[model samples]
Target: MKIQYFIPAMIYSLAFALQASANHPGSNLDDVMSEKETFFQAINEPDAPSFELINAQGELKKLADYEDKIVVLNFIFSNCAGVCPLHSARIADIQEKINSTPMKRLVQFISITTDPGNDVGSTLEEYGQTHGLDPINWEFLTKKADDPEDFTRKLAMEYGVKFQPEEAGQQMHGVVTFIIDRGSRFAAKFHGLKFKPINLILYVNGLSHQEKKQKQSFLVRWWEVIYYYFIH
Candidate 1:
């Protein structure tokens, strides 16, 4: 009958209620958003294609390094005069919006270069600045010395985009912004620059909320088990 004894019961009830709401039909936010947003394509690949690349600081980085954060990923080279720049600029815009809110800490922005040969050293460090991408939660990645020249290009293809090199230092490719949810689930993609930035931000917010609810449900169940043993 004590107030403290009722705390666990309240939490358990609330957790179950949330779980029920989450399990209700049409409750999948990713699928709902994909249908509502014209350019957003929702996917359910269990594991995103992995990659090990180098950051601008010459340090090694991998897809797993961002395990707990939502990833906004794209591919670009420093020298392109075409859609690469446009795609990066669009990402920069999205990053700015996300950073303005508390969600900044929960998201990471990644740009992998298809032209590692030219996008080395200062080129890697300066590309973000030139394109308005902040270095706070963003990285411009390139292949390492031991990697093949087309290493990142192949990885990009795995993500469903191709960076086919062409004459005059240009590469032919479509622009796509991939959204990888926490735990490396390939959640969705925003194709082309036509998609509204707000739509992507909202989708990411939905994913973040979904993850929070899952964690809360787990903690509630854990607390209930501990309380049951303590009462006896």
Candidate 2:
């Protein structure tokens, strides 16, 4: 994949301050902020929560099955007029770019609906079709009958987004696009619609070339080292 390399101002601004304080401690803020860093915020590397969900065809799907491929996950409801449409469009743009490259098969896209009641069968399929999301690697999903009414929304909460039903039948919620690394199981999140679509593509492109590392945190690294020498 061809990468468009440009640092976002806000992300670079915050990243410089944080990395400088954490790494150099006494470095000048201006100098620290000038240092280049990738903005895919490394978290505690939480295990991405997976649950039972159904696609537009009402077939059961599980997140764990995609362990061999990179997963780009988002939350949206078909009936939403606010951010969901724009969010879907942005994802569509990213998909078009990805499909042109070899990264296409390495990635999968999922958007779980907040309005499963309205988005079913053809309705769910049309949302993806309208957005030009390729069905081979993308799915617009909803909860099956056995799952709780709010099961999918509750799962979205695990990814750090909250949703509540508005009086007009729309939901008040935040937009987050998540990238889950294959096998390594650590998930990184890109928050909000303001982030560039190319930035996300660049990130996944990086992950595709990444040699899978087992533990990310310093503590976890040391613990594993000690176990290998002593316990093993």
TM-scores of the candidates are 0.79, 0.73
lDDT of 2 by residue, 40-154 (tens): 4443264678777898777898888787788898999988878898999989988877776666777899899877778889998899888878898999889998777788789
Clashing pairs in model 2, backbone N/Cα/C closer than 3 A = none
Clashing pairs in 1: none
lDDT of 1 by residue, 14-38 (tens): 3344322121122356555565568
* lDDT of each candidate versus the true structure: 0.77, 0.67
Off by over 4 Å in 1: 1-27, 211-232
Worst 10 residues of 1 by lDDT: 18-27
Where is model 2 more than 4 Å wrong at Cα?
Answer: 1-40, 44-46, 212-232
Task: Please estimate how well model 2 matches the true structure, expressed as its whole-model Cα lDDT.
Answer: 0.67
